[model samples]
Target: MPRFMGFVRMEEGIGMPPQSLFDAMDVYIGEQAAKGVFLDGGGLYGTEDAVNFVVRGGEVSRVDGPYAEGKEVVGGWSIMQFDSLEDAVAEQEKFAQLHAEHWPEVTVVATLRQISDGPEAPGD
Candidate 1:
């Protein structure tokens, strides 16, 4: 099975989505979990306190502000295991629809990839 990382971007100053919407999402996640499809999920805070890290001249620099140059920021994400990309897409579409209704301008991204287990040997 493959895993998907789904991100939900939220509109600026809109606050969190309604509880009912979150409840629906939670229900879907719970159902998936019951069937062993859910790996992990979580909600992120507003980007106001975010700090972006950059490496310059072999040194690290931290910059304040949301890294995205958009009206919305990723307010949350979920990682789920699925049989294929199709399954992940189907699941993500539901969230997309809900988000569209709640945050019309927000972007939704779902990237699917195979989960990799670290090599047994060091630096393998």
Candidate 2:
């Protein structure tokens, strides 16, 4: 089975959602977990609490937020294993629909990407 990452992009300056919305999300996530589709996931804090690192040449530098260029930030992410890309996409659609129906007031964009397996080992 291949793994996919589903992420949520949130527009800058959006406030926390209402408790009712959180409740709905909990139910949806629970269902996914019960179905064994959800492997791991978590939400991130706002850009205000974020730190950006840059490595150029042989030097490393760090920039502290809130970053002005960050108009959109990743709000959350989930890792799921599926038999195919189509299956992963179908699962993501369910999450998108939940947000559309329950968190209409919140600006969120959900996206999915397949996780690469990386290079093979020298000795297998």
Candidate 3:
């Protein structure tokens, strides 16, 4: 089986999602976990207190958020396993649909990418 990483990105200061969205997500995630398609996943806090190390030239520096730069940031992520790429994509689509149906007032971008365990093949 292959594992893919899914990320949900949105504006950082948009506040919390509606309760209905969380309720719907609980049911959906529970079903996925029962089927073993959902490996591990959870929502993330905003970057207000986040810390990062950056390298500039030959020096390293520490940066703190709310850095006041980007409007969009990753708000959540999940690691999921499926038998094939198609299956993983299908699952992600359903996940995105949940946001569409329940959090219609917010703009959410769900991104999916395979976790590469080795070097890519030619041209890939």
lDDT by residue for model 1 (1-124), tens: 5666777665656655667677777787788899988889888877778888999999998988755676767667777887777777787777677666755654555444445556443212
Q: Scored by CA lDDT, what does every candidate get? A: 0.70, 0.84, 0.90
Q: Choose 2 or 3, whichever is better by lDDT.
A: 3
Please list the residue runs of candidate 3 whose C-alpha ends up more than 4 Å from where it truly belongs after superposition.
Answer: 121-124
RMSD of 3: 1.9
Candidate 2, 14-102: lDDT as tens digits: 78877776888899889888888888998888888788789999888999988898788998999998877888889898888888887
In terms of lDDT, the poorest run of 10 residues in model 3 is 115-124
Off by over 4 Å in 2: 120-124
The TM-score leader among the candidates is 3
Clashes in candidate 1: how many? Answer: 0
Where is model 1 poorest over a 10-residue stretch in terms of lDDT? 115-124
What is the C-alpha lDDT profile of model 3 across 56-113, one tens digit per residue?
8989999999868888899999999898888888889999999999989899999999
Prediction 1 global C-alpha lDDT:
0.70
Estimate TM-scores for all models.
0.74, 0.86, 0.92
